[model samples]
Target: MKTLTLLMTMSLLLAFVWERVDMVRLGYRIERLKSDKVRLERERDELRVKVSSLTSPARIAKVATEKLGMVPPRQDQVVVVRLEPEAPSPTSLAEFEIKLAKHDVSRKVR
Candidate 1:
């Protein structure tokens, strides 16, 4: 009976120790993930700033003029394109309503 009790006590102690070790391991993992998330977020913000600078109109214009040797268009060199307004749709609501009214009136007359 004494040996059995000792065995039970040892088993319970080992279980407790194992659980504590697992908890510590999980805590370290959580810390590592948090740091990684922060680092990635910082990198994303830096990349966003870089993209904005690279795509800015002023930067683009400067690069075009300096690297590509592009020149601004003179007044006569520029061409303006005008888009004509589209005609109203054939099946407009007003036309549909007029047709519907005429059909109703003719039916009533009949």
Candidate 2:
């Protein structure tokens, strides 16, 4: 009976220590994840700032004129093309108009 009680006590202590070790390991993993999350968030913020700077109008215009040789159209060089009216038949224009009306109605409803 004494041997059995000793064995039970040892088993309980072992189980408790195993649980504590598992908790410590899980806590370490959680800390690592939090550190990684903070690093990634900082990187994301830096990238967002970089993107905004690159997409600024002055930068875009400068790059277009310098690197791509793109220039603004002069008033005399610009020619406007007028599209002919589509037929009343079920054409793409009519379909687009129907979709637009549906969108407008949805917007109004909202």
Top-scoring candidate (lDDT):
2
All candidates: CA RMSD (Å)? 18.8, 13.5
- Candidate 2 residue-wise lDDT, 11-110, digit = tens: 9999999999999999999999999999999999999999999999999999888887666755555555544456665554433321111122222221
The true-versus-predicted C-alpha distance at residue 29 of model 2, in Å, is 1.0
Which lDDT tens digits does candidate 1 get at residues 1-110?
99999999999999999999999999999999999999999999999999999999999999888887665655555455544435666564332211111122222221
lDDT of 1: 0.75
lDDT for each of the candidates? 0.75, 0.76
TM-score of each: 0.66, 0.69
Name every residue pair that clashes in candidate 1. Answer: none
**Cα lDDT for residue 22, candidate 2:** 100
Return the lDDT, model 1, position 6. Answer: 100
